[model samples]
Target chain A: MSKVKIESEKCKGCYLCIEVCPKKCLEVSKEFNKKGYHPVEFVNDKECTGCGFCYQICPEVCIEVYK
Target chain B: MNKILSRPESLTLIQHSYCPGCGHGIIHRIIAECIDELGVREKTIGIAPVGCAVFAYDYFNFDVTEAAHGRPPAVATGIKRVLPDRVVFTYQGDGDLAAIGTNETVHAANRSENITVIFVNNAVYGMTGGQMAPTTIEKQKTATTPFGRDIKRDGYPLKVCELLAATGGAVYLERVAVNNIKNIMKTRKAIKKAFQNQIDNKGFSLVEVLSQCPVNWGMTPKESVKWMDDVFVKHFPLGVYKDI
Candidate 1:
């Protein structure tokens, strides 16, 4: 199984990852970071195919994929 | 446990100094990733340009040197000649490479200096506010050109890849963008290729990335990416303009 970790502090909430994820496994979190942008969350992790689209699209390089 | 992806070892733990959604962060990571993959950290020397990426030294974990505004190529040439075995590259913005440093860049390419140049073209000068740059497109509104760029007065947005390709000494020249998932991946491949060219002793490889500037463009991060795709990419078409 692949695990997706979002580094909230480094995330600028660009939502590029969420838009590119084919599985729709990511969503904007309700919480806010110090930068006031809503960090994305990994939802339904089991559905992740680990295609790494989110990791590739993230401008801030805030996502890490672990298996 | 297997790690599919993580921060590239060539990058430091320091948070980037760029504003939110800036392309500099993305480009920095791509360069760092290339360095890590090539296992050239020890011998890699990155020359930071004078514009927005001036702080590139702080981010890249490997050896970094600051060069005068638009003078990275000249500096990089000196370093590469002195330390021929080292993998040398320069990170420069449009204003630095295309504007003030044009002469240096042209001559370096003509000489076929064994160095990689990562040219980030956001059309506007990011560090000093959104001013008109040599790469700024026609009729594009900027701080200096409020009403939009006048072609007759300001001249056309420079096609750097095309210009450099004319220099027979340049072995590789590509224009890539980071506006989407596919393009981002292509951009990474391009970066890696440019670096590999240096390791192979190829001369004068330059990758012009059509990056976005959200804060200076006065748009949100998402909007900026879209603008880069729709407007910016039109002026600077993506692909390898030359390969030898």
Candidate 2:
């Protein structure tokens, strides 16, 4: 199984990851973290291909993808 | 995996936007090489500032954030505080750091933010028309300072390393130039140390690199190096100012 993890606190809300995700599995969650910013969340892991696009696009290095 | 001259995995294939003989390219390559050598390409987050290098996000293979002019330090602060395990760095120019963003740069150093700063001082502003910068030397003519920088009117060149060293928060501070082969090697070492400091959680670290601006300085590539060797170094002496 492939999974994506978001370090919510580190997320700067750049949305580059969301834009780069080919599968469109990630979205800015309604819930805000300690930074008071809405971080991204993976709504469906099944759609994730583990392409690492999101991992690469995340400017804050807040995302990690494991296959 | 650490090889000199070999391109770093963190750098993208696209060529930089800097002009021919520009020092920004050299500084960028040294930083990318250092990141590759440290094997932190995967964990490093770079904050791109608004300047000639504003498009740095396209050049680095690693994750990158684009911050407004002189705001890289503030953005890096937010990123590093949250992702303490990851390495965060900012590539800023003299116009951005010593001029408009002086407050952000100073406070970030005063707070000892756990991050690395690569300060490129090319004496004059490159992105915006050739203009006088905070680090511009006396008697240097720019588009704005047509009659040469007047000492009484224009302030002295800002020595970033000297200013940052006064703050106890900074763990490592060095001023280096990339005008020659020997100096390039030293600049690489200083860059590596700044990144190492971040990894060791040693607080803020900065390497002020004296760079050449042939396009803005109105000099040829070769002339730029000579100018750096003759005039730039005299004002911004190269050396490690603080190491802890």
The sequence of per-residue lDDT tens digits that candidate 2 reaches over residues B1-244 is: 1111234567776756676567776687778878988999999999998888899999899999999888999999999988899999999998889999999999999999999999999999999988999888999999999999998998788888999889878889999987766687798899998999899889999999988887788887667778898988998899989998
Give me the displacement of residue B156 in model 2, in angstroms: 1.3
Residue B128 of model 1 has an lDDT of 97
Q: Which lDDT value does model 2 have at A46?
A: 84
Q: After superposition, how far is residue B183 of candidate 1 from its true place, in Å?
A: 1.1
TM-score of each: 0.96, 0.77
Q: Cα-based RMSD of the predictions, in order?
A: 1.3, 14.8
* DockQ values, each candidate: 0.66, 0.02
TM-score of chain B of 2: 0.97
lDDT of 2 at B185: 75
Task: List, residue by residue over A1-67, the lDDT tens digit for candidate 1.
Answer: 7768999988887787887889999999999999898999998778888888888777677889887
